[model samples]
Target chain A: AAGMAAPRRLKPLHHVAVSGGTHGNEMSGVYLVKHWLRDRSFAATPFLSNLRAVEKCVRYVGRDLNRTFTAEFLSSAETEDEPYEVGRAREINQTYGPKGSAQAFDFMFDLHNTTANMGTCLIMDSEESLLPMHMCHYIQTHYTQSSCPIYLYKLPGEESYSIDSVAKTGLALELGPQPQGVLKANLFAEMRALMACALDFIELFNTGTVFPAFKTEAYKITGRVDYPRYPDGEISAMVHPKLQDKDFFPLNPEDPIFQPFSGEEILYEGDSTIYPAFINEAAYYEKKVAFVKMEKRTFSIPGLHTLSLSPSP
Target chain B: MTSCFVIHEAPVRRVAIFGGTHGNELSGVFLVKHWQENGAEIQRTGLEVRPFITNPRAVKKCTRYIDCDLNRVFDTANLGRQTTEDIPYEVRRAQEINHVFGPKDSDDAYDLIFDLHNTTSNMGGTLILENSRNNFTIQMFHYIKNALAPECCPVFLIEHPNLKYATTRSIAKHPVGVEVGPQPQGVVRADILDKMRKIIKHGLDFVHIFNEGKEFPPCTIEVYKIIEKVDYPRNKNGEITAVIHPCLQDQDWQPLNNGDPIFLTMDGETITYEGDSTVYPTFVNEAAYYEKKQAFVKTVKVKLTAKCIRSLLP
Candidate 1:
């Protein structure tokens, strides 16, 4: 029983990657990674994900690059008719992932920014993942200037689709309230600090420091809420002005959520209270998501340690 | 011919072009700078075109303003206030601007004022007028409308009785707001800038033609008249919990139906419009208006007929 309760030791990360510019208009990540490449300040391999979109200063040249990383798209044979993002996804998968494999990069950090005022958010693939959880825990406990919220994007057994999913273990660092195509100096600095902290955590873990078990809070995605639409598929309503920048805030049932053109207030009819993130995100409007609803859960993670290279006594 | 109102006005010789009213809006900030350096593009045979940046301090910092909104500081209440050592920066600037281009409703004021602006909303090139009934303004609106693509520019009228507007343009007898957008604050897009340039060119040309004794015939044109403004829903702590419904975003100048959705709450609830009649919305999600506690302004589409205008010079 004592042996079964022992801390789990995992393989040390050898190759870590940091990617940016998956959505071109997100200027913080795009410029941060570019600065890193030019300065050679950070040791991690800096990858600029979408060159064409970055040059154009648009979200993407073809389809959204972040959404183009599913198995169906990655494994499909390359053809002349394939979209630019699809081809890029395949190349990225080949370079970093071939995901869920031993040869895949140990960790990948994808940087993103939202027009929504989400502040600093860390998006993890699963609630149970140990390394990313430890990294997020480290960031939350140590980065005292601002509160960093952890968001669990994947449900149990769900397939991964985002660009960060290419690596074995990954997290998407999202910061915002900054508009697309514009760089806010404060946000850029925050992103840089967060990235440095994450890298420090990786170095610490690599040096074989054991991370203790702890309980932390995270918002898990439940379902997506789309904007109300007309019969012709045109969106009929907008994100309520009340919810414009209240990302990660508790939203109660029967609260005023939307204000239509008629100036009437719309109330939430859900039975349970929920916390929403990405409220009024500019990019999500085109994707039909008014906001992503989330359920707050407290997670207790087990202590983690790097695999012992020496023979056990 | 049927009944028509003919307008005869003294030559519109002194025209002032104001930019950087809200310093973060870059299209006007840069355009005004360009025209101030080289006057050939905006110059006319008989008119003295003065392109000025209203808030240079704010422009230097690339912010909206130093204290309060410069655009809202031009009202008589603020302008007539005693100059104190501790007054807000914009109030002083407004007074200085008034002293140069206006004294607000004085006969010595400039003949016409073209104040440039930008919005975060998807409203295309828009001409805003305080007095929708004025013959010269209506003729200018009609002329600019005829010159540019109809879908690119629309006229919006904010009915402010008693000349109570706080805008910089309100100082002049005839004020035309050349507002364009879908631009994010602090950022400039070539497409948006080019569209603004075209609108200004057409405006200058219209004035040039009018000064040369050309008469504009009476015509009926579609204009959006401001009805009211709605505020965002807030909690006890004043935190917002919803966003502009996706449907309503970027749908500026489009007719908003009674049952259409206008907002979506954070908890994924849909909010529908309950108005009895359809209305058009402008300045939807304007970045500058967020601080003013307004989500969007509603307007009803109406046809405005302008009288025939012949310059008093001829």
Candidate 2:
């Protein structure tokens, strides 16, 4: 029922939604949004009012809320027996869908956290958007105070079935891993800043001043694994599991998971070191491995909203 | 044996091209080499060509610049005067390259010049023409797009006033720096090289000269957005401690604003903003200037204009 409302009219123009904590365990945005919801003193300011005046605002909880925006999934909600997050995604889409069409919302962001040690990343939908470099610059300047090493991720050719692949303009902010104690509050503030920047871009878009462009060259990756590999034989468990730029294991060369069997020497390949190695012992089979980094190129795409990969040059 | 060739068989017209300023960026290096090896087979009908392989040392080192980004050292007043003997080996090498390519006493050595480079980010696909909205820059963009068939997107032409300070561009009356992306064994380098070669061949066929009246392409200028600045923050033990979030993508991020909580030192005390009333934030790995991981960032936005776009013609 929340999906049927007309789009909210705003003075500036365009609309955007920046949602975090889609993975549940990456609780940075969860707590920040929680704080905003519970604390009146924080939300009563004029800045907070301006943020609320925007077209749409989203605060999500749980994993995979980012994976439910396809037309097929949107059509069969009740009959498909979907989970609450999926249904919530459908509701958001319906309300944000184009004025006459079922597609709702012009821009969307799914915020997340990565391993504590990984670099900050701006993961964008490569197909629909183009200017990742510009976006990276904006993110670095506006969100992280030019202090965090930001990277641009272009989805590999192999793993195009994920949720990020569908949206016209969507970015996943990986605030490095779950924080502990004091670090937790810091992470929340980072998420809050990221959200505020997204809101600013939305406001800029509505003002007709937001011109989006993209670089054609993206970090071309070749492999990704949804499952984790257990140590077999003499090979000790990987003290640090990471993705390789080239080569694959467990069959298909395109297969995501690659592990060195016991007693085998580890070989280092590619220009950079291994990345996105999962540390959580309880990670689901669908959450363990990610795409391996490979060659990338810069290109340009012309459109109303452009996706740019803003990795450090 | 590696030989440098000059093609002046055609009636002399002022056009100079310098490639391989940065040894690591090979698109321009190979493109120039290809033309030299096959000049007779690829020379245009009536244009004079001067090609120089500047910064041979840095090229050997495979660096972005010889000493201090040779591209950044161009000054008309400093012409012919060596800056320093104690500078890095690369910087010294850049001075030599500058002397060889720069105009001696007059500003009429060449009508147009091009300095080529490869960038690490994916932002190098487009041609970067220096600080003017001239016809030469405009036509060069058209020629490049038509000849090279670079990635199938619209070419982005950026103009920075500070670019006038660039050594290669500043030395000549008209100079353009063509960035081809990183050379670190990636597809971007390969594609850009292919495109560069195509443009070189097309230039030979068109017979366009820098000072000659060859029509240039139309280009729009865009500005660069400096998104984030990285600082490495360190703890007392020298281990990386906290990542400060000073800038936010969302507009609601403010200092001590509701959800805003400052990170604490390892001993569990919050680090507050000591400066101005504005929100100060820092990312995770900035350099540790303070004892605690309490660095902050200030975000600013600016727009790029379109009139500065130029072409690498003549």
Candidate 3:
């Protein structure tokens, strides 16, 4: 989108915030916001999260806008007036949230894309949220054409920091294999479909249409794995052909994971088979992450209290 | 270390170096500054080297350019036009550069031009952006590639689909040098600088050899020949929504097949390469190109032959 219009103040029966461009270069949400901004009939208070970054086509000018949403970070906003993102983060919070407080969005859709082959996945801050889990299950079942996977990225002990984490109830829509600053038509349509589906779910929820109980499969984050490095800490190897682009696939023990410049294949010594995603993600190079491993578990949606009642998940 | 000077050393007439064409690319700015301060250390017999920072305002601001990209404003038409207050900063700079050392088609112009640039792409130590008539540039690259390690001498020859040479290098009667890195903007890496220094030294030596009556062998080198540019997946709003696929990340110079995965959605769907044949990619996820909205460029790997390297010598 050429220009970013400010978010419109809307008074919906249930205030739902649909955001794109939290990481400005990620374009699906950016264009969606731009398009909706031009005509707001379909948009329920559309928010173009990081306008400057969208125009510059960078992730952010300073720190990541998506990663600046934690309560602690928001509380100490004015203490360090350095990066441009901190002020923008506060502006977004004041506009849509101030989350966990009384005046906040009833629901939020934080759109994102990944270098990872994670498919049309729903990323949540907590797995214990009933409404989000139900929404994820509904979207996965309906959005069959798209590779929809659910991931509980934020664990038990982690603080919520993403744009979605700021909403009273929100899930970040993660799409991928598209490069930052570039958008694809097929994927764009898929994201649009998911958004419409999410809006429909919210509508149904408000209308008291109880979603039928269903089992949903999700990937649970365990730990981040970095590239095989030399003693000097330089990455000594790259993702092997077998392991490269195999996001959400089972990574077996003793599998050839890295191919060193010396032509030697490095194996996974861990005994348990773990599913890996975000393999060789461009953004993760700075983070030193080669991939992130997760555990796969099937849990039924709407388990009364939204707790995993079908044994340990 | 493999070859020795025969001592029939004839002086190199003139060579020009350009840096800070894009101010945000720090390696070029810093390297030129270092050379301007202490180029005498690398000084060899006969070659008269001149170094200049092409865009001072951009360099001072730590931006790619001030008014417009200096690299794109170097066409003869733009340079030949009389300067006006209405012209952009880069246009005026190009005119100044042309005045100093150009009318590049002329015989008195700089013998070889080294236009230094850095990128956020994983283009290790690339030499020569593709110019079909520049056989001399390729000869210098051949010498450097054989002399250096693989990481220090990767070849990425970009052939623009429609436009002919418009970069700062195009201003040179004969051009050579690199667009290097995996380095961020406004950042400098010593290792990359070291690589650039080696290439420059070897290039100077090659010129020395060329000036002498010594004949060099006919040569061929494999080059990733850039054919076309691929933009990131966009919505109807023309905004990009995907990141470089993990399969394709840091895969510069690697072969991409017909059905190879090129992009991944945030939702995890794989967007595949629909090309008919396998092609190599370069400038993969280049930071500067992000503003230009280019994800990466596709290239055909080719064996470029110097039909007669020695025959060019008079």
- Models 1 onward score TM values of 0.57, 0.37, 0.61
Candidate 2 Cα RMSD after full superposition onto the native fold (Å): 22.6
Candidate 3, RMSD to the unseen true structure: 11.0
Report iRMS (Å) of candidate 1.
14.3
Q: Residue A293 in model 3: shift from native, Å? A: 1.1
Give interface RMSD (Å), model 2: 14.0
Assess each prediction's global lDDT (C-alpha) against the native.
0.82, 0.43, 0.74
Misplaced by over 4 Å in model 2 are: A1-13, A38-63, A77-82, A98-103, A127-134, A141-168, A179-183, A208-218, A225-236, A239-262, A268-291, A301-313, B1-314
Q: B61-118, model 1: which lDDT tens digit per residue?
A: 6677888888887887899989999999999999999999988999999999999888
Across residues A1-313, which tens digit of lDDT does each residue of candidate 2 receive? 5433432222232344445444444445444544454455432111111122111112222335555555555666474555666665555555555322435444555656543334355666453443334444466667755344334454444333233333345566666544211124456556667667656655554544545443344443434433224343111223223333222111233322333222343333444433332222122223444334334445554434322224324
> Model 2 chain B: which ten-residue window has the lowest total lDDT?
B282-291
User: Per-residue lDDT for B1-314 in model 2, tens only?
Assistant: 21322212222355566776766565666555545545554455455666667766765443445445566555544444456767665456545655565553354445556676654333334455554354445455555556655443123333444313445555665566665542231111234565555555555444444224332223343323222333324546554343343333121212334344344433234544343334323222211122223343332222232222222333
By TM-score rank, best first, the candidates go 3, 1, 2
Per-residue lDDT for A1-313 in model 1, tens only?
5433566799888899999999887877887887677676578988899989987666898899998889899999999988899999999999998877788889999999986778999998887789999999999988887999999998677788998788889899999877766554467778888998998898899898989888899999998887666576644444675676788888899886765423366788899999988876767756777788999999888889889688877
Off-target runs (Cα >4 Å) in candidate 1 are: A1-313, B1-5, B160-164
Error of 1 at B240 (Å): 0.4
TM-score quality measure for candidate 1: 0.57
